[model samples]
Target: MRERTMNLLKLNIVVLIEKYKKVTDVARELQLKQPTVTFHMKSLEEELGVPLFHSRKGRIVLTEAGRALYPYAQKMLSLHNEALRTMEEYKGMGRGTLRVGAEPAVQSLMMPVIADFLKRHPGIRIEVQVEPEQKLKALLMVEEIDAAIIEERAALELPLAFERWNEDEVVLICAADHPWVLLEELDPGQAGQERFVRHAPGSQLDRIGQAWADQHAINLWSPLTAASPEGVCRAVRAGAGVAFFSRKALAGNEANEGGGIRMLKVPGLEDPRLQLGAAYRKEGSPASLINEFVHFLRTCAQI
Candidate 1:
């Protein structure tokens, strides 16, 4: 197959000639020399091995082949202009689209930036997709999203760079009807054999909970396991068991109503182990939107 040699300049010349119908006018509009414009047009016709335009009444006019190529040429020019504008707008202080991913445990923390960013940069759009950490890591590796706010643990195996977004301290909660609800302090040592509803294994919350339990020599039982915060909330509220989550995950949320659930300050609980942060591919060049949003995450100072 013949390699295509068409470029933005040639496409622009064709589009201009179609609109202006004269080499002199086309050159003036493009701010190009008439000879330069003529040369590009001739080269494009040669590259495609087709006659594109001919002189009619001393004005250049599209021939049948040129007419056939008009729509494609126009489209190419439009895309080229759009590409430039998309890249340059943010540098000029305009907002651009930011695609981000996060795990549900940090969804609350991740979502507020969406509103804040759009309010400050009205031209920007932020799309946040919530998924498990493993899936998020996969997406980050492939750059399916620009960045991620996720639970930080052992160094991610993926090629990426990141900054700490938050140190997520786990909060223990139980249904109001649970015996532990009215207590102001939960002694993990006393948790002996008490059941707990937990987020699925491998989740940061689960790991933190396990460590806390181990540190206190507590033998906790998981009568029920959940895959989402909602599931854990539902189970605990139903009196099935207690669970734990980062404070941001439940802040302002009606996790307990009518004494549905109560957060407990577990004594001697290990300090917050889940580190939340923003990460992007090490090799990827982040757009202004990504950089600005990451900055917002760092300075917002609250989840």
Candidate 2:
């Protein structure tokens, strides 16, 4: 007799068992009788000559062999579904998963807009990862993420495409009660006399602040350094010292609006500015998804 054949149903049953780990649940999802599903499982195991799942406490657990096969099975099913949908929609639909990387400041500030895009395009799945500018750039170069939203593109000259979305100026922020806030005209020369709460040395924001101070012949007395925007904000709120923040970050805050913290312009210092951009790999790119996402960002920026 000829050997039996493996079918899509059998693969689906294995995937369902791995997901729910209960025969009853799998049977319900498949809309088949429990015994029939169990029979298919047995037949599949015999054909493959390996146990796909092990039973424990009346629940199903995938075996090592089953674990290895699960991902491939899932991908096959996904491709089948995608093909059907593509045909049904006459190849006009934009569907698939988009993985994006962003820096901390962008993640916190821009996530709402990104979430809105997801809501509008419910068919498209999105995953956002937070990383520093350098790491985000590295991931883009390696094709690890589809795209990235980053600040200060001057560090690495990677062979990638970028679109400028917005520009923000770095402002010096201090607690409302801090003596620096009361100054009539703030100059970078005052940096040495004040204890500064700076960002980590490697960050773009830190570099800008330090460069501004140095150019003005001021010594930066940084006793504390933070790796996160929120940390620097909190330290500034606690009267630690003045730190540089983006105007976009301070906008709409009660402190900024009601004068809880003061935003001072540094005289004779080059106003540090950052251009936020959306970047993607230039070769073999996912053109449709990238275009849609960039359009969505442009709409958001307009609003």
* Candidate lDDT (C-alpha), each: 0.76, 0.76
Q: Write the per-residue lDDT of candidate 1 for residues 212-288, one digit (tens) a residue.
A: 77876777789799887878887888888778877657664555446576776656764555677888765564566
* RMSD of model 2 against the true structure: 11.4
Writing each residue's lDDT as its tens digit, candidate 2 over 1-303 gives 649787889989989998899999999999999999999999999998899889999899999999998998898888889889886543343566778887765665677778898788777778898776778777887888988887646423677777667677777888878887667886556656788888766566776777777777777888998777777777888888888777776764433445567777756655457788788865525666777788787766632
lDDT, residue 39, model 1: 92
Q: Which pairs of residues have clashing backbones in candidate 2?
A: none
Q: Candidate 1: what lDDT?
A: 0.76
